[model samples]
Target: MSFASDNQSGASPAVLNALMQEFSRNGTSYGTDEATKRAEDKLRDVFDCDLVAYFVTSGTAANCLALSALGDPWGAVLCHHQAHLLRDESTAPEFLTNGMRLVPVAPFAARLDADAVAAQIAAMPDDRPHNIRPQVLSLAQSSENGQVYTPVEVRALCRVAHDAGLRVHMDGARFANAVAHLGCHPADISVRAGVDVLCLGATKNGAVAAEAVIFFDRTLAREFPERMKRSGHLLSKGRFLGTQFSAWLHDDHWLDLARHANEKAQALATALTSINGVRIAMPPEANEVFAVLPRQVCAQLGAAGIGFAEWYGDAILPDKIELEREILVRFVTSFASNETGVAAVTLAGGVLSR
Candidate 1:
């Protein structure tokens, strides 16, 4: 009955089964096992390119370590103000980069365009010795506001960043959802779009905890192993992380799970908007639905044990929408989400509205 977050959901059956199978076996440690190799190979096959893929236990570790490699100590990484790296990661990027600054760029709907990035870079002081030089542009696929960046948009942003001598990194914690929403291949929106590195996340999708830091430009990944070790992110039982991803990617299981979650979110958004005094704050682009409901209705939903969260960020609200007595809420669906839970929430809202 919880719509609070995909993170609250349990691992998918496929992922759990893989973990169980791997737990019974003895394998080499520290990413030297066959399972770890298979997982990296799976990522290469999916991306359709030769890449350096390193597995880690969390999105924060993947992003921080990857950004550490992309940015220098005196450089700046440009990203949307509401990006997870900026708002949620608790300064891990700065700490991992040994004081590389994170420059916030304002972009509508959490999608950063080339112009916005270029302007941010231009605004920095010309005196390189006194001001941090912008060196990386970080984009969030299926952004914090749940808006997916199209391939063309990504390519344009990357071109701008590259022209300004900045590398591009994508925080792809919801990569599967974005690909499912776009109906495009992963490479189309990432590697081919000039993303230098991508933190491919699986924890929110289905795995217990698994994220991959993939470098499209292999040269950028050369130092990642040392970084992982130094940062205490290198797992001794690395096969645990590898097995989950290996199962998640096999037979396109990841996409199927993401599509199911996205469809459920669409259905939930439609139901929410149908209720009087309830309206969507932003488009339901991935597995997240952002809506504004009358305060009384929100209270009713809470009383009925329908779990959701009060959302506060840079979501673009509908014009002329009044929010004096309303609450902006977020509902997240996952591979384990069911129609019963969605229907229950909608039924509660409908009952309360009457």
Candidate 2:
């Protein structure tokens, strides 16, 4: 009944098998091996673009490097105030970009609308000599709030950023789930929608430590290899990542894993909606469900050994009267989630009501 995080899950069987197969053979190092080439080719086919793809160990590296490719030391990358770059990555983006700044935008949803994005860019004076030039816009698909953006929404955001003379980057930490939830081809949400770069996430889905930095505009990533190599992210045992990603992309393995996870989340959301005193914080999209559980409900779940994180907020009511306080538990279902696990969580929540 653990709704803590998808990261808590293990690698899928198929991904593990692929890694074992690679272990049986010797390969070149630093992304020059056969496995690496196959992974890159598979990503090009998946995104349906002649994009430059590089595999990295973690999502943070993918994001920082992708942004670094779009900016110089004095440039700025704009993203949602709660974006991983701003709130979670511990300043790696700034460091990787050689002191490039991350400017936070407002309107407060995990997802940023086109107008809010435009307003922030327009507010930054273009003529200031000392100001960090606005160079990139990074958005999270299936945003931090667990909301998924449709194809049109992604394109609209892209159009705004491009018009502002900024390249767009997507922190696709949940790329597989977003693709599966939208039931659209990967290209529709990325290259075709004007995204210049994307961090194609795999760790949070099913792979062990596989993540890819996909540059849809090849011209924008000319110096990325140097950036990656210099950062110590260029894995000498690179085929390990490649082996996992290849298995993830082959025969829609990634999508299949994502679909299963999303299905579990959807079922959990449906069950929660039926429970009294529990509020749905965000509609279920992809594999994450955010909820506002009553105080007693939260305590009950906690007592029962179900794990989750409190969603960020003041956690205090405006008035002297203490309201429910709205605990935001992040319920993440992975490909490994089974019917029994889902049902167990549902029953636990039901205990709060009784």
Candidate 3:
């Protein structure tokens, strides 16, 4: 059983078929092809709003360029301390924004705490020439900690950001899963809730390498095309990226893929909770399950060839984890997860642990 990451999974059959069709045809370069237009139109229908969509190959490129569009080079983008931009992106934001600061705010379960967000913004005012102005607030839906933020929570954070004259951005690597888990309309947590831009991701769900930077507030996307083109992210063979997204969104395939993954995650969580001494790190809201596994249990799983990640971030409270004997671990389920296979593994472990 492999629960290492969704990135480890291959492209779904439907996405692959769509790509193969595009491979046989000749198309215009630089995102001017029919596939790119279709993908953008479908995305606008998904959100039920008029939006500017730019297809990019990677979420990192989508995030950095979108942030670069919203914030000035001398300004700052605020995000959770555990956010991908602040921790995982490796200074791409700094490079793309041309020296803008990535300020990490205190995190609540790997999410931005609106109160802390307000306080942090208050500390840096435009009136102070020496202080870096906060120009953007980026939130990771289905946060790095594997917790999903609800629409109400998103609206509150967005309200705080907008009140401070800062545009809000969402790192939506798991956006599909978040929507599936919440059973809410895609617009509820995005444009309707005041998000300025979203980095819509599909590669982590089922596509090969498809990501879209959607501008819900078109004003924020004024210079984004140049930013994307200059960064070498605007693919010349762009239809491949476009076709993947087009297929991913059609027939509600993206939601189906996400729902299956989420179902498997919940199944894994339920199975693990029955094991003696094993604790659910947080109630999983999406496709990721975090657990505090006893040391014996960890060794046993490893010996059995089950793969997972050892988590050490502040996503879970230290007091809740028994450092002396228990280890914090993350198990990520994907569209490729076989429910019966994973269930068998966890069920056997539960019996053995008891």
Candidate 4:
């Protein structure tokens, strides 16, 4: 049983088949391929907007490129301290934005409220020569701690960011999962919610290695192709990237995959909740569940060969070795995470109790 990460899961059959089909026909190279254009059109249709969606190789590229569109070298991108751009990407946002600084705002879990972002921008000394001007506010949809910001929350943050003369960028790496959990229209958390740019993720959902950089403001994406090229994220066989997104978006397959993953996570959460000494750490809003498990139970589960992460957190009761001290563990369910895998972990928990 593997609860490692959604990225560890294999691609969906649909996406694989689409990739094969693209390989079958002779197509143009780069992003001018027919499949690439089709996928771009599909994204515009899906989002119900005229903005162009550029296919990229990974979510990092999408986010970095999107940020590049919003920032100048002297500008700063404000994001939650725990955001992927801040921690995971290892300063790719900075590299892509041409040496722009990333000024992390408050919220340890990367869930930023609108006012906090605005307050920071307001506090910045714009007249200072050395001070980096705040240009964009990047918020992760389903934040680092597996908590999702509601559509209303997104709107509020966007409003605040824009009013402070900053564009809004959504790190939508887990966006499909968030939308599935909330049961809202995609636009509700995107353009309608005032997002200037969205990094539409596909790799984690079901695609092999694909992500899209969608700019709601067409003007911002004008020079993005150059930025993507310079960052080495522009794939030579661009149709491969397009094919996956095409299959993912076709007939709402992306939503289907994400919803299945979220449902499995819910099932896992329910099972964990029923076990003694197993407490949920911040209820899951997406496919990720954070649970607190007893040391014995954790050892028991690990011994049984279930794969998961012991997330980083301060030990509340370090000396209580045998007691049920809180240990935050991240359990991520993916499209391929079947009932058998879920049962394996939950049943192991039961066995540990016995």
Which one wins by TM-score: 1 or 3?
A: 1
Compared with the true structure, all predictions reach lDDT values of: 0.90, 0.85, 0.88, 0.84
Candidate 3 lDDT, 1-354, residue by residue in tens: 789899999999999999999999999998899999999999999999999899998889999998888888889988887787887899899998898898888544456778999988887666657778999999998788887889999999999999989999999999999999999999999999999999999999999998999998788788777887898887899989989999999989999999999999988888877778778877899999998989888888888778899886456453566678989899999999986758766666766676
lDDT of 1 by residue, 212-318 (tens): 99999988988788899999999999999999999999999999999999999998988787678888887898999988888888887789998988887345666
TM-score per candidate, chains pooled: 0.97, 0.95, 0.96, 0.94
**Residue 133 lDDT (model 2):** 76
Clashes of 3: 0
Badly placed stretches (over 4 Å) of model 4 are 107-110, 314-324
Worst 10 residues of 4 by lDDT: 314-323
Q: Considering summed lDDT, which 10 consecutive residues are worst modelled in model 1?
A: 313-322
Q: Give the alpha carbon lDDT tens digit for every residue of 129-167 in model 2.
A: 767678888889877778788999999989998998999
Rank all candidate structures by their lDDT, best first, as comma-separated numbers.
Answer: 1, 3, 2, 4
Q: Report the lDDT of model 4 for residue 214.
A: 89
| Comparing 1 and 4 on TM-score, the stronger one | 1
Model 4, 16-88: lDDT tens per residue?
9988887788778779888899899998888888888888878888888888888788899898876788878
TM-score of candidate 3 against the unseen true structure:
0.96
Per-candidate total of colliding backbone pairs: 0, 0, 0, 0
